[model samples]
Target: MAKPNALHTLAELAQNDTEAAARELGRLQGLRTQAENQLNQLTQYRHEYRERMQAVAAEGMTSGRWHDFSRFLDSLDHAIRQQTTALEKAEADLLAGRSRWQNNKRRVNSFDTLIARADAREEKVAARREQRTNDEYAARLARDNASRLN
Candidate 1:
């Protein structure tokens, strides 16, 4: 069995790794949130722009103005598509980060369990050794007393 100190050191290192993983997971979550917010904003803007264009058309707009609106709406649609793709990628990255954090956490837990078992084993061995020593001392004292009585 490995020494308790060594197991403790490993457990500490595992704990540090778990903390780092958690930080990375947090960063990834933030990025995913930002991407989703940006996507939502772009979608909302596009919807409002379409509504505005319809209102302008109802009020009698020139051909040039109508063409400009059409082009702008198309561009907005493209941007929305791109943003959607970006959001998907961000979500995937967040999932991977979460998985990494969970794995690191499991490693930390395993190391902690090993350390506990090692500690318990050491304590048991020490207790047995103390019992043996006390038994020997008592037996020797009994033998010496017997000799003296002889």
Candidate 2:
């Protein structure tokens, strides 16, 4: 029946939807984890640099290790900014992925209405066939009785 075929098609769509959603979710989770890790690593880096600077000042090295530390600190700041930008981009990517997942869900849900419509139509056909068969049988019985009477 058409209902069975429709159900099979819907089942296939459901499987594809699930697989796509899982992949998207995984990508979003991974991005979030990476962003959080970077944030943690970037925090307090400057304070550590300052501590190294104070030690260098006390050690009285002819070489300007302090300058190098300051430059290193500046670089770390830039790296943090870059990381923040990357994190924002990742969040946007996650949002986009989520939107796609929602669209897939909607697509699958729409098929339910289609299947219901198909089911109603098939029922009408069945009812009409049954009615016609009953009428034909009644006519045949009436003819047989009339002939016997003759």
Candidate 3:
């Protein structure tokens, strides 16, 4: 009776754990994909910036315009540095996310173990109840036969 209810609660808890982990995995996958895309785009931007700088150097702007060209290059250099930092941060986050996913996977296995234990307990309770019923029926039958004989 109480055993069955406790088993039911354990089963429900296991189910809830599975559901929550799946949802979290889905969300993490989406974030991971987005981060990968951003990293690729940043890499491409860096390549294009290098080519543009090379083209500007080939054009060889005049000394009168040197300061302005230098300032522009400096600005692009700063932007590249900033993008590098962002890319590193994104990689770190991706690693951390994968670690978390693995940890959650391990946690879900514990829930499965709990579910198994609950199922085993329920089976024992059910077997005991079935045996009790059989005993009661046998007693009733013996009483009836004795009365009929009398």
- Compare the candidates by lDDT and give the number of the best one: 1
Error of 3 at 125 (Å): 1.8
Lowest lDDT sum, 10 consecutive residues, model 1, at 1-10
For model 3, what is the error of residue 2's alpha carbon versus the real structure, in angstroms, after optimal superposition? 7.3
**In model 2, what lDDT does residue 8 have?**
63
Decide which is better by lDDT, 2 or 3: 2
How do the predictions measure up, each by TM-score? 0.90, 0.69, 0.58
Winner of 1 and 2 under lDDT: 1
Off by over 4 Å in 1: 1-4, 148-150
| 1-150 per-residue lDDT for model 1 (tens digits) | 556477788888889988999999999999999999999999999999999999989999999999999999999999999999999999999999999889989999998787778778889999999999999999999999999999
Q: Could you give candidate 3's per-residue lDDT for residues 31-149 as a string of tens digits?
A: 66676676577667667866775687688766656666567657766766776676666667666666666666666676557667767787898999999999999999999999999
Candidate with better TM-score, 1 vs 3: 1
Question: Which has the higher TM-score value, candidate number 1 or candidate number 2?
Answer: 1
Clashing pairs in 3: none
Would you list the clashing residue pairs of candidate 1?
none
lDDT of each: 0.91, 0.80, 0.69
Model 2: number of backbone collisions? 0
